[model samples]
Target chain A: MTITDELLRNNEQYAAQFSGPLPLPPSRHLAVLACMDARIDVYRALGLNEGESHVIRNAGGVVTEDGIRSLAISQRLLGTEEIILIHHTDCGMLTFTDDGFKQSIQDEVGIRPPWAAESFPDPFDDVTQSINRIMASPFIPQKGSVRGFVFDVATGKLIEVTV
Target chain B: MTITDELLRNNEQYAAQFSGPLPLPPSRHLAVLACMDARIDVYRALGLNEGESHVIRNAGGVVTEDGIRSLAISQRLLGTEEIILIHHTDCGMLTFTDDGFKQSIQDEVGIRPPWAAESFPDPFDDVTQSINRIMASPFIPQKGSVRGFVFDVATGKLIEVTV
Candidate 1:
């Protein structure tokens, strides 16, 4: 069976006890952009529940044009005010570079993508850079509450990164 | 005091109970692409824990160019074989159009972005489209295990979409 079948069976149980219809805007007026790493549990690590905060994640949680577009809507249409960027230790993103990865894919598939890998050497520095990216975004409003953190995957702890 | 301060204070308590070193790759070998809706508790809703599934989320989880890049790396390098696309009802993406949103931003900021909002009217159809996008991506291998679902924000249930 596909994972879809398994998850559907699981959702049957979840729906049996479903309790929802939460508000549209997050209660905390906050949004988190974090890595897609499996080891970092954004909600549990940050003590968030449903309807509390918006968790926007992607590889490395790097601020991209698409991310900025999302954040723009999150602030303009929704009511999110604070932006938090979280990258994690032992992230797969730290394993490769843009040129190196593209070259590898080119060698394998005979096609080079016109996109970026957005890899970084250190999670700490990446977080700082992401924080600055969001802060510097013309789309995001005047919220000086932008910050970044390095989530320790081994320990489930978040370490703040100053920019 | 910013939200950063509050989160940092919370992280201090969480780190006190730190346990070190989970493996580098996800244990479940699954990757989930979903919306950044505040009401969807991805981990709880899907019964996922840290170190299980790689969750890639953005505004609508619509499988952008960047998302494809991330998924390619996830499968090629991280050993993730299955992918699940989850979009939810009452999503903010349903509430706007690219042209309209771009015009609004241009009015407000005097600079129009070169990005698309990637808005969709129906979450179910959008999920299917995303699944097709991933499956059609040349970078993604012939996994044939990709699936999509529409999560009920009001019911905490995920309904599978047959594509």
Candidate 2:
């Protein structure tokens, strides 16, 4: 069966497994900021179960305005004290040229490039750069600790990039 | 060079190319709620650029309490009105048994399993179910739309699932 079909079936099973709120374990409440690359399975990589940590993902794993905003809120309201930024290998963000990506989007959907004035950033090489970018940002909570890592999609191994 | 190296290098180039605030595109302020599986590249998969969308990720792409809380803020404060949920294949959430995962954590880290009360809910079959759950949720903006999809990690193709 397709992944979608499989997931739908499982959800039904899960809904039935618990009649009320599935009792969640008390979460240590760590927050992770990582890339949205499909290869990095946060739960498995961190060996976490439900209600353990809050994970936020985006392209390049860079801390954008919204990312920072969310992180701020997570720290202020969600009880997340630690942050982990996980970037991965062979990210398509590195493969596509900015002009090419814009052109492809324009051609596919018949919509003009939204941010034609802005160029796309390439995020390949020294994962620490992205980590540093996030750490350097003023939006992240100054008091909270931030960690960075490179997750190898092929091997499922996580290598620490920065502390 | 390895994909990780390439991504870091590419990010530098990307940063150099777009040095200022990106002009927001019309209808570009969207929020994507997707899975944390490593195989999916949100930027390439959905043709998104740096300032286009806010991506919130978790296991099974499920909209947990934190996700809903973020969605409220993203919609109310961050100009995000749309939501997309993407789940993918060969998910570790499907293969690793909850007991195995918990036991491995105990063995490796010397910490007790946090969610000792419940088993890890298989997420492969839970994505669509999660989608439905999100749609039915009262916290999501009533006027906003939620889209669901299952991405084939092996092929890098996206198939739309029901909303």
Candidate 3:
């Protein structure tokens, strides 16, 4: 059986004890932008229960245009106020460069990607970068408390980055 | 105290019980693209542990160009072979059209957004659209097991979209 089938079975188990239909808006009035790293589970790391916060994630958690789009919707439509940015130590984004990644894809596919891969050199700097993007965006309101942190995968501690 | 402080306390607790750093690549070789809805915890819903799969999320779970970028990275560098796309019922994406959302924002901010809101009328059709986007992208090499599902908000169950 495929791993997808295995996860489907797991979903059946999840649904068996699941109690939901929570309100559409996040109850905590918070939103988090985190990396799509397999090692960091956003909810458990933040002690979040279901429906507590809106969680947006991508490859580097770099707050790309799409991240702004998600955050804008979270604050404008949903009732999220505070924003959290989580990048992690030992992130894959740190291992590569944007130009090299795009070029590799272009060499293989014969057409260069129109977008940057958003590779970053450091998680701490990228967290600050993400916060700055949110602060600079006219689309995202309620930026009074946007904080950024680097999650240490080994210790599972969140070290805030003061920019 | 700010909710960020509250969550920082929670992170301390998580760290107290934390385990060591896992491998960078996903153990299951899987990737999940999901909505940034508060109620749907992708790891819990799929019964995935840390380091098992990459979870990429955004506002509508729509496969935008960024999603393609992430999936390409996941497959090319990270070795993820399976992909799962998740959209949910009662999603905010269903509440408005792209033009209306951008127009409202433009009316308030005096500059229209260059990106579409990616609002959709139905979760099922959007799941198909997401699947189609993945299938059509050449950057993402693995198309054999790209499955899409509509997460039922009330039921907390994943319903596969047969597209």
Candidate 4:
């Protein structure tokens, strides 16, 4: 079986033990944006119960335009007030530059991607800047607690980015 | 303490029993894009072990340009071959239209968002269209298994959206 099929089997097990639907809004009134790294399970790391928070993730955990959209919706429609942003150590985005990645794709596909690859050299710097991006956005209503952190992959400890 | 502080305390416990840094690339060579809903824990739902797959989530789990960027990076740099797209029932996106959401924001903020709110009438139809978005992208190298599903919130079962 393909890996997808294997996962479907896993889903069956999940469904068997699953409970009914929960409420629509986040219980903790929190929203978290983190990198889509394989090893970082946001729920466990944050000790979040199911239905407590909205989890928004992407490549570098950078606050792109899409992230703004997600955060806006989270605060506007869903009653989420606190925002947490997580960028981990040893991210793939640290491996290359945006120009280089775009060039590689352009070379292979004969068409350059217009969007920024958002590869960053430093996770902490990116986290600080991402927070700024959020604070500067008029779309996001709640800027009261937009905290940023860098998760250490080795220890699984989240170190707050304080700059 | 603020909720963020409380979560930081939780992280200490997670780190106490936490394992070391896993590999940067997903061991299962899979990537999943799902909604940012609090109820759906992608790892437990898919029965995925940590470090097995890259989990990308956003507000709607729709294949926006940002989703394409994440998927392309997953395939090109991280070696993820299969893609699974998930939308869910009782979604906040289904409750409003793009125009209405944008208009509401415009009325409040006096500036319309340039981006589509990406609201849809049906999860099934949107899942189909999202899959088609992946199929039509030149950036994503692997279109072999771009499957889309709608997660039933109440039953905790995933129904494949085959249109």
lDDT for each of the candidates? Answer: 0.84, 0.52, 0.94, 0.93
Poorly placed runs, candidate 4 (over 4 Å): none
Off by over 4 Å in 1: none
Would you list the clashing residue pairs of candidate 3? Answer: none
Ranking by lDDT: 3, 4, 1, 2
lDDT of 4 at A11: 94
RMSD per model, one decimal: 1.4, 14.8, 0.7, 0.7
Q: Residue-wise lDDT of candidate 1 within A1-163, one digit each (tens)? A: 8665776677778778888899888888899999888877887788777898888888889998878977888888899988888998888888888899889889998999888889899999988888778777788884667877888877777777877
Error of 2 at B143 (Å): 18
Which candidate number has the best lDDT?
3
Once model 1 is optimally superposed onto the true structure by TM-score, how far is the C-alpha of residue B108 displaced, in angstroms? 0.8
Q: List the residue pairs that clash in candidate 1.
A: none
Give the per-residue lDDT of model 2 (tens digit) for B1-163. Answer: 3223433443444434333333322135577787644334454455454545666675446555445544544553345666667766554345445566556545654654443211135444465576676676554553345667666654455567653
Better of 1 and 3 by TM-score: 3
TM-score of each model, in listed order: 0.96, 0.49, 0.99, 0.99
Model 3, residue B71: C-alpha shift (Å): 0.8
lDDT of 4 by residue, B1-163 (tens): 8899999999999999998889999999999999999998999889897799999999899888899999999999999999999999999998888888999999999999999888889899999999989998999999888899999999889999885
Number of the candidate with higher TM-score, 2 or 3? 3
Residues forming the 10-long window of minimal summed lDDT in candidate 1 chain B = B2-11
